[model samples]
Target: MRPSTDHPVDEPGWGPLARYVIAATLARTSDGGAVVAIVLMVNTSGGSGWLAGALGACITAPHLLGPFVARSLDTARDSRTVIAAASLAHGTTLAAAVLLYPHTHPAVTAVLLTISGLFGPLLTGGISSRLPAIAGPSQRRQRRAQGWDVATYGISGTVGPTLVAAVSAWASPATAALTLAAGCYIAAAVIRFLPYAPAPGKTADVPRPLRTLTGILASGPLRRTLYLTVTVAFSVAALPVTAVSSTHTLGVSAAAAGILTAAYGLGNLAGSAGVMIRPSHTEADRLTTHLAATVAATLLLITLTPSFPLAVTAYAAAGIANAYFFAATLAARNEYAPDNARGQIFVWVGALKITAGSAGTAAAGALISTSAALPLLLAVALTIASTLLSLAERRHNRRYNAPCGPASPHTQPENGRPHPTGPTDRIHDCSNRG
Candidate 1:
């Protein structure tokens, strides 16, 4: 069982957590709103969901190159300062897009969005890297904080689209896009007020971000986490595009898309709350099994559902699973990543998640024209593949840990410490630090 919450860190009243939540909410609101706005803008203007998906891909495309940017930030003096700079750049680019989108071609808009995406790592991994510092020194506190962080993503996912839908009803998609830009600026300001803590350890000692990523990938726990992230990304990628397609298929108002999005977000929020309120063992195998099962079940339900309301409910159920999966992976990241390379691990993990999602979204775009249900079917297949992988991982672990057999080098406990037998010594070693 987990220890009691008597640590000073655990009791750090809501003040600091609230500050971080505000920043997270604002940043994610912009992200969430941008997806809705872009989809609405393209779909309303006689563009296929394919074009809208392309724009979405463009926004996440930068994640493919974001590790270098994240590496630079990791080596910087203050991660918060780096975040501020990235937020400014992202917001400015979005503002420019708001102004130029009307007068410019769709290609220009895509370019601006991609430019804005260059800063996505800052909004996601960069900000998340601060949790260790922000949540104080207790592992439990950090775990709880990570749960809250996931909840913020859900909250923003809800609020952002709600804002877009409400504003678009009153005005135009351009105005909704403008509101997203404004939210980014607000987030930037809020983030500035968050306490800044320098990264732990000497800047010069930190490995190159690529090296950091390679090292983390060597860790069995983290490698499993990354694999799970890839699967989650594919499932999530189908969400935004699928929501749009559902709007078309159901003959519903455009605003219904936002409501469906909100249902998923609400489910995410509830899922996060479940973790916070009722602590569990959180074993990787059990969590993986539960997550995969939920993904398969959610997708199948959505695929078979006959009506829009049923679809929304199915998505919400999936959202709960999504939120739980994220919480598990995030907690794993915090627990297993060494202090020095934590930033890089977070960066690459976030980048991988985005890249996978982008691929899924792009694939959905390509297939949506053929049949709206195709993307969901593809997601189910991917989810099953991921489940098989998880089972394989579990089997490998069981065999490797058998008393009569040679212990696997990757079989370290979650604390990231070396076992006495030395089999797990190299797992996330972090220059022999672990």
Candidate 2:
């Protein structure tokens, strides 16, 4: 049986354990990078565009079912075992991909590709579920966990494509991609094997993942968070697809496209440094509204950007907005959680993200090549979406921030009791009527 509660950093498992946490997270990020690398490799090597893109999707497909799968393991009291198994599965798949690449041929490649890719979701699910157990009950720690994950994704997004280029320069693109991906698995194995203070694991009465997701999504505050998150995700997925396409095939060089992409990343990095902003509350609803305005405003500027420098500035601003948006959403999600079903909650949140991202990506695919109106359409849609989110925030703010004398919609009378408001409190006090 696993130990109850998360282990402190000084625990026996703590030394290797801290490494495990950091490395496993970084490994996960690198593995995600590998997925993108593989897609780019496939694309450049005359593979079907759809097929290559689909391969990238294969790696992330697990997040959709990730929460549920992890929940099942939690129910079984086998979280540690599940994570261990997932690590091994991930490593083995990468090894197998490398071994089979040479002799397997294209026909066999497709057949075995699914088998290797399948481990991705399982691994992600396992790692995600065990985090709370490993991190203890601190909110800051939890945010750290999420931040680590985000940093991984952000850095990977920035560096992965470049790695593909570097790898391909020396070896065949297929070989290089596989080699790099396999390296990540090796790193993951080392990280995963490092000792962790076992957690008895989270047990909950909420048996169904969908049920928790549904309940949270049904709540106005959370539902709006999900919607805005999706909006952002969609816009993000679209920008890379459309911006690159328009710049690349139309009139611009790939170098310029890459520069613009870098600008987006820089913006995210700037935004991610949230500690710099004071009085900066992350009450999910308020933060979301603010970010929505920032990003929506940034995107509005996107369509108007005429030069590369202007485009880059706008993209960077958009990224900062996005980073802040995600951070706020996560903070709020955790704050409102019932405590018993956080994993399930985040999973459903993950699903909403996937759904939103997928929808956004699909829409971008349609508009990237065919129309000038696509980016504008996306920006306009995002603005409308943000405005609605702002409306929700107003509602959210009122509920949480109630008035001084009476509980107005602008504020919640905390403790379900309004502040002592009489003639002494307000000039309009009812006592004056007498």
Candidate 3:
């Protein structure tokens, strides 16, 4: 169990953090590379774009069940065992898919991708659930560890595509897929060697994944966090399309679009660095409001800007706001979620974001031909609506006397026992956790 404290860990070390970060970053990089590789492999093998799209859907659709797959770790004797198995399984599936690619029907490739996608949660949320154990047993250290984890997320999203593109440029798409498969195995080996620590009270009577998800959604803070997540997903999904549209409007080459995208990536890095240096003390509700407002304002500016430079600047600032929004939501999850169900909550949140973002992306694509600025305008409207909803939610909570933190009174405990005395014990102080 995590030692209840408001200070940094006594023995500060980066060994375990480094190990897990490498493993996770490599694993995710493989995931990112495989997507591009799969599309290339299908297209090169005389398959239509529809086949490639179907294969991509196969790979990502299974992530909707990520929480259920991640629940195995919550119930396992040692989560490392499950993580190792998942990593190996992911690699094996990818290898099989690559080997059978052009020789087999697209259905066969889709099946393999679906099987591989089943392990996505282990590479992400499962690793994250171990942060307290990885960083030593203190809240402050855990927060720092999570910061590192978030940084890896930002880095992976950028590095993963670059690695795939580099390998594909040097060799065939099939070869690139094979390389990523090897990376999965290497990540599995690294995870296997890390010290194993069971989640707090591993023997606790954990509820089913669906039940845990339901309990998490019952909390005021978590609900607000989720609300923010949906809005942010919708707002950010328009970036790529908007970048392309802006490039067209400015009569610039594709390089300009890439530059705008890179600006967002740089802003993400900057925001993550700031969070690592000094964590925020704002309430989750207030953070959500600010994040939504910032996104809306930036998108408005981008829409109104006549030059590419101004658009790029606005996008970068929006990216920073987006990163901080995620940081705030992540901290709320850590503070509010019971340890035993943390993996489930994390996976569910990710799934929700992915689903919402996919919808938003599709919408933006459909509308971008009509007007470049139309999607941005829609995003602004959605964000404002979300902010208003969050404010209304807070008022309802205060009116009916909801708990201060995310958890409700009947929320399950990580230690399989009743919560400690005092109302505060049931309500975590998210704004003051440091």
Measured over all alpha carbons after superposition, the RMSD of each candidate to the real structure, in angstroms, is 6.0, 7.6, 5.3
lDDT of each: 0.73, 0.57, 0.74
Give a tens-digit lDDT track for model 1, residues 1-434: 22212222423556667778888888877866787887787787778889888886677678777777877556776666778778778877877876786687879988899988888777887788877666765555666788889988878767888899899889987788888888778777767666555556787888887788787766666777787788878777787778888787777887798778778778889888876776445554346556766777787788787888888888899888887888777766766667677777887888888878868888999998888888988888888887777667656654454444444344444332222233233322333221
Off by over 4 Å in 1: 1-11, 35-57, 101-111, 169-174, 239-262, 284-286, 304-313, 365-374, 401-434
The estimated TM-scores of all candidates read 0.79, 0.74, 0.87
TM-score winner among the candidates? 3
Model 1 lDDT, full chain set: 0.73
Which TM-score value belongs to model 3? Answer: 0.87
Question: What's the best-to-worst order under TM-score?
Answer: 3, 1, 2
- What lDDT score is found at residue 90 in candidate 2? 57
Instruction: Kindly list the per-residue Cα lDDT of model 2 for residues 94-165, writing each as its tens digit.
Output: 545545645666445454445545444544434554444444454455455445444545665566666667
lDDT score at residue 428, model 2, on the 0-100 scale: 25
Better of 2 and 3 by TM-score: 3
lDDT ranking from best candidate downward: 3, 1, 2
Clashing pairs in 1: none
